[model samples]
Target: MEQYVGLDVSLKETEICVVDGSGAVLARSRVPTEPERLAVVLGELAPAASVVVLETGGQSSWLHQELTLRAVPAVIVDARRAKAALSCLMNKTDANDAEGLAQLARTGWYREVAAKRPETRIIRSLLLARQQLAKGRRDIENQIRALLRGFGLAVGAVAKQRFETRVRGLLEEIPLLQDAIEPLLAVRRTLLEQSDGLEERIRDVAATSPVCTRLMSVPGVGPITALAFVTAIDDPARFKRSGSVGAYLGLTPRTHQSGETAWSGR
Candidate 1:
């Protein structure tokens, strides 16, 4: 009797359910969320299980990759789709969700999501860090400007390089204001240094990547933009047609149609 497996994964534990080809519950158990432990439990309970389904989440990508490495046929399903199907049940519990997922696996009625490679995730993280640092620097600068304005001191329209000098000049005679704003100026300086370092590293990575280099060749496409585009796409092969790229990036409008009426909107 062939079997199918479903895993309702949480941070620390996973609820597992096994079912036969006819969708009859064969066994159910709780195991640690670690890939090795889950693999061991599955081997003991459903050694012949042909498909194991899990939902997409923070840990799903790592678990799916690790399980595949252990020779388990792991499938990552879209959580939204799985939730829609599972909502039909009266009782919402991990065990019941596991059973529903097992049945979904048996009937092949779920959408499988592709897990991104670790390298791509790393690049994405760098981009996010750089963005946060830039935002933080801007926020600090804006706060300094606002605070200085409260005392009728306007450090207006100054270049970034001269911002600290301008602030000091405006607050030179006000000892209390100087004391209040010096710490913030120091923080802004550190943010500037860190942001510059991150940008340098990002440019280096983009320069070395053949894909990013090609993307940067387009007019107005800089290193940062090229790297972001490359990381966002991850795999070019996923798109069958180049024209569909605009839709994938959400640049195209959404369309709505009925029996006779049709409309498009952002």
Candidate 2:
């Protein structure tokens, strides 16, 4: 008889449950969260397993790739949907969750999530890092502006290069202000350098990628935006129609309709 397996994955370990076609629990066990270890355990416990279900999470992509390499039929399910289905049960322990996931797989009632390729993840990480550094730089600039304003000084409409010079010129005679603002200025300068480096790296990656180049052909779409879209989508074929792309990006409005009444909101 074919068996279905569910894996409730945590940071350190995974709770595994195996069930027969009729949803009867055949085995329960725990193994380290590493995919190799889980694959070995599953091979022994459910060699005839038809499907293995796991929820999408921080480690899901890596685990999915590893399991596929080991010839395991692993499926990554939408975590939100899986959580809703599992909520029907009273108990919510990891073991119980694993059992519920196994039942989900046995019944084929879970949404499968697409795992992006490693290349896409790398590009996405670059974009995210750049965004963080840029935000940090802006925050520091704003703080400096606010601090200067407290002393009745306004850093009015200056370029980034002149920002430090203008602030220093304003506080040159004020020793206490100079001491207080120097460290913040140093941090802001470092952030600026790092942000520039990340931007160069992103542009280089976008320039080299054929997909990113094509995406950039769209009017007003630059390297960063193109790279972000390409990495986020990962696979264009995943969308059945082009019109669904707006909804996927959360650009479409939400609609509510009941009987004859209808409403839409952003």
Candidate 3:
């Protein structure tokens, strides 16, 4: 009397259905997508459920991690593959998708995607935040450039820190234009300061990391870039070939060859 569960999860609600071995519907309902609430619902279902199926999405990793700790069999199938399986059917809905996923699980016709390790995920978040700060700083610089261009003034290739000092002198010569740029420069100063702070924090993290220290020993790599690369990789052993390191950075050229046609260097 083994049962199987399928969950179609969204931000606000989750549609769930349980089916027995004979494809008989046991229970079906919607539940809140919060981890604790979903866990409670799962506990209420038959304990003998063989497998629970969920399509890949943002919350799937969290749900999978929680279920693993509880010793529940949860399978996160690839969304594209699940959709292809469902596309063959005439009608589609949340319930139908859930049922299809459950049946697919039972039939052993699903592909599992890898979930990020906790440490890797944390480092990735830091890298993303650093990228945002960098982009903001660049936007502020572009604003300064655009303002200078409007006045037909070219402060050619000055250092980032010195550019402001030189620009201020030019601003005094054109009081009208200076009025427009003064506020932007004030905001730019704040943004530049924030970017410098973020960079220092990132470097501090790298300074303490043994992995980053080892990575920085390589030629043509600096501490910050080395740390970024090492932290992103997390586990070097996961890659079968040493060459994959360069490939991951997109330094290697892609290639496709046939009997008569060849394509490479992309």
Candidate 4:
């Protein structure tokens, strides 16, 4: 009998449930959340051609990739959709959710998602890290402004390059204020350097990537936009139809004929 396996994954444990084509429960077990452990359980449960289903979550992508490495076919479903489907269960529990997922698998009612490649994820992580540094530097600058305001000093209209100089000029007479804010300025400088370095790395990556390079061909699409779009989509083949890309990116129609919905703009 063809079996369908559902895994309700958590950080510490994975609750697995198996069901046959007749929608009868076959087996349920708890295993460590590691991919190796889950693969072992799957091998034992799925004797014939079967499907393993899981919802998108923090670890889902990693699990999917690792399971594929172990020769296990894993399907990732949208968490939001899965939640809506599982919500109708009379009594919800790990086991019940697993069973529900198994049923979805057996019926092939759920949509399967392409897991993001590690390279794409790595690019995104770099972008995020750079953004974090930018935010931190901005916050420190704002804190310095607020502190200066307390002493009736205004750093109005200062350019980015002149910010540190302007702050120092204001603090020349106030040694105590300089002492207090110098450490923050040092930290901000470090963050700025790191952010710049990350940006340079991103530009290099974008330059080398054929997809990003092609994306940048469009007017106004620079390295950042091209790289971001490429990373966001992960793979162009992810969507069966190119028309679905706009919808996936939340680009609703600007002008509906009845109202004002149009989808012309990129």
Comparison by TM-score, 2 against 4, better one: 2
Off by over 4 Å in 2: 149-159
For residues 188-212, what per-residue lDDT tens digits would candidate 2 score against the true structure? Answer: 9999999899999999999999988
Estimate the TM-score for candidate 4: 0.84
Order of all candidates by TM-score, from best down to worst? 2, 4, 1, 3
What would the TM-score be for candidate 3 when compared with the true structure?
A: 0.74
Q: How high is the lDDT of residue 158 in model 2?
A: 93
Residue-wise C-alpha lDDT for candidate 1, range 38-153, written one tens digit per residue? 99999999999999999999889899999999989999998989999899989999999999999999999998877888898898889999999989988999999899888888
lDDT of each: 0.91, 0.92, 0.79, 0.88
Per-model TM values vs. the true structure: 0.83, 0.89, 0.74, 0.84
By TM-score, the best candidate is 2
Write one digit per residue (lDDT tens) for candidate 4, span 1-266: 88998899999999998998899999999999999988887888885638899999988889999998999879999888888889989998998998899888898888787899988888988888988998999999999999999999989998888999999999986779977899999998999889989999999999999888898899999888888888888877768899999888888755435456555434
Could you tell me which residue pairs clash in candidate 1?
none
Cα lDDT, model 1, residue 119: 95
Clashing pairs in 2: none
Candidate 1 stretches with Cα past 4 Å from truth are 89-93, 149-160
lDDT of 1: 0.91
- Give the range where candidate 1 is weakest over 10 consecutive residues by summed lDDT: 171-180
